[model samples]
Target: MSNREGEGKLIQVKGLIKKYGKLTAVNGVNFTVNKGEIFGLLGPNGAGKTTTIEMLVGLRKPDEGSATLGGYDVVTDVGKMKEVMGVQLQATSLFELLTVEELIEMYGSFYKKQVDIEHLIESMMLLEKKSDRVKNLSGGQKQRLAIALALVHDPDVVFLDEPTTGLDPQARRVLWDIILKLKEDGKTIVLTTHYMDEAHVLCDRIAIIDQGEIIALDTPEKLVKLLHSDNAIEFRVIEGELNWNELPNVTKVTKKSNYIYIYSSNLQETLSHLLFICKEKSIIFQDLHIRAATLEDVFISLTGRRLREE
Candidate 1:
């Protein structure tokens, strides 16, 4: 589904901060999310992505700063804010004995306006498991059910924290389709994820957080373009290491273990020079791979650490 462009901002966050004793969970952070857009919070664990979401959703009061959702201040109008927003937390606890349809109905009872039970089920692709008990459903099915409950109230904005963390590739793609469908229906989405590829595929714009602060925010393509090189050539050297900076068109070089990575804009020149150098030096290069630079590389470049690493 195509995104709704030119939509006005639906969420505003300013100087958002949350503290726990001597430690700060979220430092001064700010960003806005437009209506009918998918805004992603991408960061490693304990980077405060969840804290920021909690502050925006009224689950946690910030030590400093403020946020507003759907024109209502999260602090001053938390009840009103809750009416317009739905949340699927990182760890969702559900009634194990309840059937899927019953669970949806139970959550819908909390809202004044409720969506059709059958339609919500089908929308989440849980029609086949509608009558099954929560405990009997697979991990993917349970995750979909949790999302279904979040939408039963027909919220204007939805918050998903690590929605596809543990799902397999196929199941993750299914959830991606469902999320895109929601965007097509004009619902604003705010998501936090550890998966760089997921953020690249799903988010209209991403805010990269690290050490309790937002380090960068932009569209996926724009973020990746921030790097000097757009392509990466990687291989392992068995004989000896050569000065990577001497390679033609090489912008940056990173070496981890036995593998060396060269980032370059001119892939053809870089590949040709690398091959020539390998032949001249009699360096036995193994497992050669060349691919486009990605958000993962961007994160590593920015933080000097991988997304999953502490």
Candidate 2:
């Protein structure tokens, strides 16, 4: 994407880099976020997703390159740029003693412009918990409150760093709806997430970062198309062993925990080969099934590893 600032492109990053002594946290990173778009940085833990967001939002200084939000340089004009930016970090520290309503109001005092506190609470699904202290809220409720605090200023650009991390599935879905509504309200969002489904559902474009460098950048559909396969086979091996990629019609292989995912160019032929190998090796497998290619498969094909590998 072009670095030229305009009405369409609200954020820009070029050759950004960060270092902690000998280790480079982010290396030569570059991208642009369009206005009213949910752009994602997708990768595993410690894959530079959080570091990149921190640098762009001025939480951590970049050692090289430059970026701008709303045409204000993130490094040099942080104060001016921050006025139009709202941030919900991966871990947000809130006043434990304050009620949800009190916390939202406290944050509102930081910005010159303020959105309706009650409306923000309603949008976050925190209306019922408005009287509850921050420490008394459930995990999901606390996350929503953190997000509400970010939006109290009604900023043009919002940075959400793994907003759904550590949340239950139901709570995660609730946050997803809130994020989508923010876009409908004309807010540009920069999202960092490791969950394949989250990135597929929420992101307009994704940057796949690994080991401090971006390996790929494209729409979710386009990224999956890179494998040149429509079918994926997944199962757990109960006995024996097989090199999945060496089997006929197989395109790629990815292993995480006890499960193995095999991508195939010809479904019937590949299944036949897999059966033959299992019989020959006396291998027993379970949960075998075929499905369509997904963002997880794309990441494995590109990086030769799982997205959330420990």
Candidate 3:
């Protein structure tokens, strides 16, 4: 349950805040990302995700608090930090006139050291489009190129902002594979994403931010455990509608159209009550699934709203 775990804090944020005139973008927030782990910043739109990232990368300055990467201040030592970190902003644009290989070389020139272009291109599956113009490439190909540019310097830390936003399922899977490859090479990644499945599959730890504040932070498994819900039984009833207010041991009951979901800490006791009620007033059910709780359910409990809801 420690917010700061692991040795050697690779990235640290303390009392970070950003404001525009009277409106606050990111209130006081603090967290540290360890080396060689995929850290996820998950939140809905307008949750200050972009602002936080921009401040961390030095694109914008924070009005309060400070952030450091590997003991170097992001603002004061911006040049030093920039050399060791690579960033891919959301909806990043590539030079349409530059060929894929040319664009990668351009990015490589920005750093003191250079990476082998042929090797990087091959690793990113961009060998086939090496000679193609940026504008002519498909969305998936453009995404690969963006990732290639981010990794051209073989940086110690990589920051990605929703790299798979508009991609199809197949394209998303491809990007997922690339992310895993980077992790296997022991690169630390910091990403902001709205896709729950993406975070669940790729992130070792996630911080759920909302309204300019971090509401929850933990490994996906640990966050799900916060619900403390076990042996959940989901079903639909036909004969008689059960009143939620009267259900004992039921901590939360939510309904969407005809589907009802009940979360209980005491599953056996709650089920006993449910069966007793059904016996009294005959009810038929379908699609009954008894399973363990998940991070999705945990988010619902924390926010009382869906993650996709704006």
Candidate 4:
């Protein structure tokens, strides 16, 4: 597939590939992140999101293709990576013995260009905990601090790999605000997240990767627009097996365990037909629900599996 039209492109990746012995972990992937925009890699776990980020950040050398961040060739300009971007991995080993302010200062000391420490602490919502030890901070606090360290040097680009993976909704929102503020402050961001809702809300454009290949790439609205169905009528079958796809006006159907989801082109007509069929067949169904098609539905249409499905 062709890449997006180039305009304000901060990062360009062409035919990027990676291999692990006999396994090709990342296929010939291609995409570009626009300047000051939030570009996301949206996929399930082990879908090569982390591998792509590693190669872009210069932690791992790509076996093929090239990527450029801030006009610096990611392949040949390994030493200049730190000058252009800041990264927060899935897990960061913080100096547990040190206080939050100390850790922030330590990271800033590594770079000649540094943002104000007070502002960094306040912005990450760690102002109250600045004097607290890293070991004493909560799980959410540690994650915030990790990101704070990433921003201390105030690089033009930021890379976050599943930043809100294990956080609660509230903590997740806090992190989300930080990300949004980064964009508002004219910073480019490359984020990798598996949560469809998160990607929908936070990303300007998402590249949906699976099995090391990008299956889809577009804004959240455009990706959802790709779905053939406008509405989804979801329910659970209490008993009996039926050909759900045979239902009228159904663009697609997916059944997981007892739950069946019918993606319908015409919602009211399809719903009426569904009820008629269930009654005629004497099929028991419960928890009937109807909603608009979303990113998960888009993934289902493309891959025939749920976003978080293993």
**Error in Å for residue 268 of model 1:** 2.0
Candidate no. 3 TM-score: 0.86
Window of ten residues with lowest summed lDDT in model 4:
1-10
lDDT of 4: 0.89
**Each candidate's TM vs. the true structure?**
0.93, 0.91, 0.86, 0.93
Candidate 4 lDDT over residue span 1-310, tens digit each: 0243333777999999999998898999999998889999999998999999999999999999999887778878777768768999997899999999999999999998999999999999999999999999988899999899889988888999999999999999988998999899988999999999899999999999999999999999999878677788888888866666657888878767667778888999888878888888888889999999899988877887888975
Q: lDDT of each model, Cα atoms only?
A: 0.89, 0.89, 0.84, 0.89
Model 2: worst 10 consecutive residues (lDDT sum): 1-10
> lDDT by residue for model 2 over 8-64, one digit each (tens)?
779889999999999999999999899989999999999999999998888888999
* Best-first order by TM-score: 4, 1, 2, 3
Lowest lDDT 10-residue stretch of candidate 1: 1-10
- Scored by TM-score, the top model is 4
As a whole number from 0 to 100, the lDDT of residue 7 in candidate 3 is 32
> Which regions of candidate 3 deviate over 4 angstroms?
1-7, 230-260, 264-292
Which stretches of model 2 miss by more than 4 angstroms? 1-4, 236-249, 253-260, 280-287
In TM-score terms, candidate 1 sits at 0.93
